[model samples]
Target: MNFSFLSPVANAVLSHNELLSMQALGRKLRIHSVEEGIPDLTGVSVALIGVLENRNSVDYIGEEYDLNEVRKAFYALYPGSWNVTIADLGDIEKGESVEDTYFALKTTVSILIEKKIIPIIIGGSQDLTYPIYRAYDNVMPMVNIVNVDAKFDLGDSAKPIKNNSFIGKIILDEPYNLFNYAAIGYQTYFNSQEEIDLMERLYFEAYRLGEVSNDITIVEPVMRDANIVSVDLGVLKASEVSLKQRLSPNGLDGKEICAVSRYAGISNKVSAFGIFDYKPSYDDEMTEMLLAQMIWYFIEGFNYRVKDDDFVTGNNHQKYITLAESHELVFYKSIKTGRWWIEIPFLANVNNKLKKHTLLPCTHKDYLDACNNQIPDRWYKAFQKNSVY
Candidate 1:
């Protein structure tokens, strides 16, 4: 609980919060302030932490940024009927060295995870995800990350890590804790053919921007199995964001991005969530309001989470067996939620990441595909990865 690296929320935001209605989210938060120091985290289910480190951004020009506007927009909103307690632990100022900032973030996130509290990180650059990933080293034997971005971000591992390529470092670095990585809303033109091939060869998942926009529900099962979820603001289309924050002309709109965030929050297995690569503008109310609503939807989704993964009791789920070619696919449907899961058979002899039979989240469509002798792409890739591991 050594959060000495964190600075208090800006006084300007506090002044703004004081004038808001009593039902505003700012009024309900356990805020860390100069007067009160860090808030007591007791009964806190979610902690908000902001990072001011953007040196690793590919377009870095020594510019500084703050989340004060985003906080103001967030605080002015009314909270849902959420039962979860939220705390704003404030921002981590840019350290003398980028590594110093990374160390502070890794330590803070690790401490929060140990207490079973989810951290909703707002960061200056997406590369900060590297430290968040590292924070999971001792907490879990294996980790699955879902990155909602327009690029693969598998930059050259041989070079210094940048926001666009930190995934390369994550894949090549030590501990080898990453079990699965999925990219949602990735644009083909933004990535090289080699990166695309690498994703397929490694059995990693990638969904095209058009594909996700066409059907947002496809993200649910992927998010359902993820341990950490990271979103890059660059995924928003040019028209949806401010001039400074725009990255692509073709990207997710406001409604789609919020849906994605809600999916991340609803995932029972997701422990850490972050939205990165924010650039503040003079009149950035549109982007700030959108980001605030995204956070709101995420919190709203978290409040409705139900544990449907427990298959110990046969009465809770209905089991179905289907044959696809020579493969026998076992499916489970939660009686309570109607959600589907496919079983990945255990191979006792292989030295694999999964030591026991595991359930992979799937859709009702995947079940129908199995009945039609068509194997789901998700099941095939997961099975392939498991076999190779």
Candidate 2:
């Protein structure tokens, strides 16, 4: 469970497939230093990840990579016209390995949050979802998670490892509990009977993909409660789409898949977002365009508002409180680059969270490290967030 997503030795070329250079992705993300240029909080933030099409560390030799254009097309999702916030995770530029790229992504999210921006992550692999959850919850409370996909991903049959089982590993290893978690459009074919039983035991709400593709209402409640979303593109069917690996035949169509993602983004609670499972190696160039289309839909949904990005609502109305011994609030410095930081608590009460914990560090890595020293392990355990997908 404590293992890294990729081997230290990349071992081959596909090791770098969808794993794009940071400058290439940064051009697509269009990053602006917040201290220098800032966007008005009239909307939400979108963060896309230009990840490798595969996650098991495959070594594809003769792979064709013309589909790199998909990243640019995907980046177009959050132009200012969308009236939404944008943060792209691919800001780290080229690296030699997946772990290097992973660290870069972890760093990018911290930068985005430092700028008061929420991000929607386009994924590298469904595996990358772990870091997103790890970093998102450190600074804010009232984090509601929603996953829209074909599989339950609740594999507990074996001991946790680098290659499989996200939900089991997240809950048992990083040790975060699911908080008001829900899911939509899951396929029965993807799960074992025992997995379904465990999901019910964990109190997750799930909908069948066949049922979701046909009825829009199936997703309403899940979206309504979610503060963040992590979408797996393989949840869609294999009709004109290409470049997808391990694509199951029993999921929703491309349009329905986009609709589901759009619904979650438009939800008033959604903050940080993630979308993974793009295998351009096996997919057609047109599939990248399809992926771009989904990203735009997410942007379209993110701009709708209930009140304002700076304010808190319903379930998470409590003000941020400094841990007993801490004079200045310490925070998650950033993502897995494994750095630490310090800030005087935020003083803006208009947003209770901002006012109480103003000068906190950026990512959850910072939060866990600081709290482990001051807060009780039980308290962190008590506030855990477990996901359905």
The numbered model that scores best in TM-score is 1
Error of 1 at 62 (Å): 0.7
User: Top model by lDDT, which number?
Assistant: 1
Task: For candidate 2, write residues 105-134 as lDDT tens digits.
Answer: 555565556555666665555656565566
- The local distance difference test score of each candidate is 0.93, 0.52
Number of clashing residue pairs in every model?
A: 0, 28
Pairs in clash, predicted candidate 1: none
Q: After TM-score superposition, what is the CA distance of residue 176 in candidate 2 from its true location, in Å?
A: 2.5
Across residues 1-389, which tens digit of lDDT does each residue of candidate 1 receive? Answer: 69999999999999999999999999999999999999999999999999999999998998868999999999999998899999999999999999999999999999999999999999989999999999999998899999999999998889999999999999999989888999999999999999999999999999999999999999999999998999999999999989988888999999999999999889999999999999987698999999899888888889889999998878999999999988999999999899999999877788866863389999999999999999999999988888888
**TM-score quality measure for candidate 1:** 0.99
- Give the residue spans of candidate 1 off by over 4 A: none
Error of 2 at 141 (Å): 4.9
